[model samples]
Target chain A: MNERDALRALAADLPHAGDDAAVVDDTVITTDMLHERTDFPPGTSRYTAGWRAVGASLSDVAAMGAAATAAVVAVYADADFDEADLDRFVAGAVDVCDAVDAAYVGGDLDTHAEFTTASTAIGTLTDAGPVTRSGAAPGDALCVTGEWGRSAAALRLFDRGRDDAAADADAIGTVDASNGAVERANELFRFTPRVADGLALAPHATAMMDSSDGLARSLHQLGEASEVGFELDRDTLPVHPAVEAVTDDPAERFELAAHFGEDFELVCTVPESAVDRVASDCPGTLVRVGSAVAAEDGITVDGDPLPDRGYTHGTE
Target chain B: MNERDALRALAADLPHAGDDAAVVDDTVITTDMLHERTDFPPGTSRYTAGWRAVGASLSDVAAMGAAATAAVVAVYADADFDEADLDRFVAGAVDVCDAVDAAYVGGDLDTHAEFTTASTAIGTLTDAGPVTRSGAAPGDALCVTGEWGRSAAALRLFDRGRDDAAADADAIGTVDASNGAVERANELFRFTPRVADGLALAPHATAMMDSSDGLARSLHQLGEASEVGFELDRDTLPVHPAVEAVTDDPAERFELAAHFGEDFELVCTVPESAVDRVASDCPGTLVRVGSAVAAEDGITVDGDPLPDRGYTHGTE
Candidate 1:
């Protein structure tokens, strides 16, 4: 099974797992993984493992209206687990932890045969009310903080083939995930999570979650979680310059912007009354992606249903 | 290199690794892998992956003087990740987790080309004090909790080896690790980390650790950490009934007892003044294994040189 199947399988077994993070009852949302590009092949400027693990988990916590606090980690490393790698991974985490004003606290490590990393992050909310996927009220305004498509671009530059044509095309066009089409793909991989944005909108937004799986998948998941459907205007959706210039296909460009996930951006539904409040309070621009409509549960573009392929994690 | 060599080499780099657990600054220590019967191939029965992973990580946590709080897991399986196997594994973990009282909160599952089980556990101490192996003061009473040599016997029986020995060996046997050996071994594999013991000893034991790498290697490590040496009396050690039944070869038996590691027991030292307190508080029986005597920087057995396999961790 790929990451998606793996997640679903685990979900099947764990009924209490919350949509935004791994919620086992109340008070925790976990997002832990060893991401690609950044951790290994040192000279490469990928995301660090510590950041990947903690940052991802941070997004999960933020999705649920919680303040970040502490974490513990276990790393099974090879003989090659040198100081430099740790300095990068842990140093990056330390920077983020400091930036967030949290503590590195405690964890453990041992040498295993392969590269294995396990981290359990814990935090507390002032109130224990879990902001689940089931909270969107019909007719709520669907707003997202920050732009999408950059992270997908960055992964391409780092892992996939990076051709200039793709980058150059996307540079002038709108909504191209094509490498050359998106000149700033590299910036996406280093995209800081929307924790600040999440915190600001937490109170006003009826329901929210970080868009790790692409825009469509995230929206679709929100719809599924809240049991409500929303309409996304293809024209009104905010597409990064990276999205337009980086790809050749206009429809795919839109899909990549919508369906391509790992954005770590927030998609939330706010009351019309709270919209201006959130836009004013949130650090980044709060773009109107769509509205939490009265429909059953699915997304529509130009009155037609959009196909979904928001990145699905697979077994490697 | 095999798992042992890999762990040894990795352990070598950790000059500041073990104080209480395998964490130094920010206090971090990590993983251990568990495979099923098919995984060991040559050795099956009376063991399960879930039990092994929990036990292994727990012991390491015990070494760190931290109580396990949560666990994150990554599982790699083929079609054989069956209901029965999963049920057994989950059940076993539930039993151990409840016994340990550590919550099984969150984890991820990824399918694999090979069958692999991995658990990343996080633990913490109430006080922020770090208990390192290097803290053993000369004249410290070298001590261990509970008995030894049960796991070896369990493994022998589980292996169902080619030797047409006269006994069921692990369960019935007359030497090395048998009876309590394999059972203890399985217990080590299935042992909940004695976090309570580690915590109790944290304030009093000058130098402390969970005995996973066996006694010899741990002794060397303790000496290395403390920058001192000691004498271990073979006769004074706490040998289990199964262990005594095994081999008459003191050196070989000791090798399996001390250097074979994975005993998951505790090897700690108390000051002469605090010895009584330690003896009374430990969850397992506290026995005088040796003493921090005057020596260059390694453990001695009855004043004679003892061969040490040390602690090895890694994939075979």
Candidate 2:
């Protein structure tokens, strides 16, 4: 079982669990962790790490269509963790909270074998209540905010140890360098959470969840939760331009579009009548990805079975 | 600068970065972290670790006189982290929340290089608002719930590698074992947060904070926040019997009483006239160890300077 499975099993005995965040009437509470080894690649600044950590959790709040109110972070670092880096980390955390219009309240710090950040974001739900992952109906139009495959392409660049070259390329405003792939990937690494988009589409959404896990995995989860399937249009999948710039394999880019996660984009199902409204209302470009189908139909892309290519923590 | 200093400095830049927890209107939010290397000693069961991690954060909510509604935990453990141990940890966390009349709503889990737990507790303020650490007035009676010197004494036994012997002693109800010190300390390590006592004292407390840091440090903090010093009566400090049993020297036991942290007991200031009422109303023994004094009076016990020997994270 994965971390999510273990959490589900443990949560079965508790009063609440399994949601993006635990909702207590009006409050939406969620947490996310970022470990240095798993999350930060070379050239990943403390500010980026801090922002990503806090933003990762806030993404859940946004997925719930809630307005974030405040956040508290718990940071564990090595004994030798630098004070300047710590300050930058906190600065990043504060900056992200400000971006979301939430207060960065107090948090705790401790020494550990390595650096780990666990952040909790608290938000208040609107009159529409929370937009859960289990509300999609058979006829609803499936959609996602923003493009895909950037984080996966960025990961490829990092794995090739070209992250520094990418940073240098961006610094010098040279996009056509030999290290252009890295530069393009780095831009994706700094993707922001689509909070405003989520808030905008929440009123019309039938179901919603962030594409933190790969889109394929998110679709599978949503299908399982709502007892429905999906028919995604491969031609309509909004693959990021950087994905093509980073790799020449059209099939590989499509796989990344389907399975690569950490996009922090809202994937929601809305009535067909409201699809255009959702697309127009959201801050980011809203792609008409697919439509929900009967559970027996299974999940598919362009009339073909969608492969299981999404990320699962503790599995990779 | 250390983690605390870093947090303090970062907090100075934010709108809400201080206080036991971030208070948003009537809600009280607090976070705390526990690491295996520094928090759990030898023979420390997963159950204890889970309970302590959740209890530590809840103690802060109680300090604020808030009614705890729910809690969320984030657990990071090695890839080889045992499934059964994880279950026990969750069970312990659930049990502690039950003890405090709060729900363990949900949490996140991930694989890490080592074991670390970061928990946040949510509570609602009472009619008394928050009993902060900055409300003490001169001439008020400074009191604490329960006894002290147990955790420090327990650490000594753990350092001696007699924790197992202590558990065995407890299992068989044998207090007079050769390693009696460990047994005594073990009992102390299993302490419950004084939630009831804190709730009872909130209405009357002029100022309050948990003695997670040694009593001396807590006093200095409360003094700094409230602009008042203290005059502690050495004879009145309710030093745990285990302290005397663990160490023969009176001065050494006294030092432990003054400087040993993680007691999870409320140290509060109440008007001198309400001292008896507080003592009679609290669930635990109300030890009148001192009285709030003018800022220049300085914090002292028996007219002698108390040594700064309490626990500080990232120190060792």
The best candidate in terms of lDDT: 2
lDDT of 1 at B85: 53
Q: Every model's DockQ, to 2 decimals?
A: 0.23, 0.61
Q: DockQ score for model 2, please?
A: 0.61
True contacts kept of 2: 0.68
After TM-score superposition, what is the CA distance of residue A57 in candidate 1 from its true location, in Å? 3.6
Query: Tens digits of per-residue lDDT for model 2 on B1-316?
Result: 6766866865766665576777887888889888777787665667777888898888888888888878889998777776787888888788788888888887888887767899999888888788888999999999998888878778776555453444565544333334545444455676777777888888999999999888999999999999998999989889888787678999899778778688788899999999998889987788888899998988888897765557886565
* Per-residue lDDT of A128 in model 1: 36
Model 1 local distance difference test score: 0.61
Q: Give lDDT tens digits, candidate 1, residues B1-316.
A: 3443333433443344324334433333455555542233223322345666665666666666676655555565566565555555555654565566666543565444455555655566657365667778789899887667656544554444323323645534333334343344444345556777877777788887777667887787778778878889888777656555566777667766766666678888889888888778877677887789665746788887665565454322
Interface RMSD of each: 5.6, 1.8
TM-score list, all predictions: 0.78, 0.90
